[model samples]
Target: MLLDRHRSLLFVVDVQQRLLPAMGGGEGCVARIGLLLEGARILDVPVMASEQYPKGLGPTVPPLRERLGNAPVFEKITFSCARDETIRTAVLGTGRRQLVLCGIEAHVCVLQTALDFAAEGLDVSVVADAVDSRRASSRELALARLRQAGVRVVDSEMVLFEWLERAGTDEFRAVSKLVR
Candidate 1:
């Protein structure tokens, strides 16, 4: 599907420092997610991030922190970021239709947030490769459930290329190198 840069927002969910290392194949997902963010930057997609109770889990990773230095980040006690007023307000304030998601504990924060957003009648895309649950079975179940519920599950590359869209835009060359 076409992912218009102006109509979409990237939501990085609860990929806190302590929780991150425990996600299955998480290190790889984190690095790929960083690349995804880079592509979004080149394409000019706005981004919002979240941390699930930072006092206990810590902040987002250093690489992501540096890239998104000034982007607003909300700390939440709820599993679903939709439950956090600040995050909800910040996301709604963006005036974007589609929410593209990526990050950790796929069955918890990622899954819960996607379900809530979808229920809010917003189009959602779960970047499969960019999300994790720490447990293989749990992630697999979450993905299946998300699909059944009509959330469009995708990979980082899909969102990146969709944002780029055409072959000749200035972002193409830079984004092309990313997928390879």
Candidate 2:
């Protein structure tokens, strides 16, 4: 299904300073996520972020934190954001059924969160290129498991374009420049 900007919310999960260095292709993942955030802003999609165990993991990386603007940031120890009451309420409160997720540790937090949201009947999509684990093998396994369970696995570009839905407008122009 095409992503509808009006019906979508971007959920950035645990792209913390301390955790990011452990991710495979971590820098590239952050870059893609940055693109997603920029596109989301241009398209007027609401954004929410999570920091897993912030005391230990530190805050979201400076680049992302700066871009996050006023987006709500939830702190949680739960691997699945859907399992965390506050995060879940904030997400559900948006009334957005389509969730675009990106962040670290694909095999754990990202994977579990996707599964839980999908099971709860949310239309969940994980941006594959924007999420990673310390091991490529683990990321691959997580993506495989997500697909097997019927969560849509997509890339950042797919999300940006889908949200844009057409070309030639100001939103399109701004979002296009982001991926360039």
Across residues 111-131, which tens digit of lDDT does each residue of candidate 1 receive?
A: 999999888878999999998
TM-score of every model versus the real structure: 0.97, 0.99
Residue pairs with backbone overlap in model 1: 106-132
lDDT of 1 at 108: 89
Number of the top-ranking candidate, with TM-score as the measure: 2
The per-prediction tally of clashing pairs is: 1, 0
Q: For residue 57, what is the lDDT in candidate 2?
A: 93
The CA lDDT at 29 in model 2 is 94
**Candidate 2 per-residue C-alpha lDDT over 1-180 given as tens digits, one digit per residue, 9 for 90 to 100:** 899999999999999999999887999999999999988888889999999999999999999999899999999999999999999999989999999999988999999999999888899999999999999999999999999999999999999999988998999888878878
lDDT, model 1, position 160: 89
lDDT of 1 at 70: 72
Scored by lDDT, model 1 comes in at 0.88
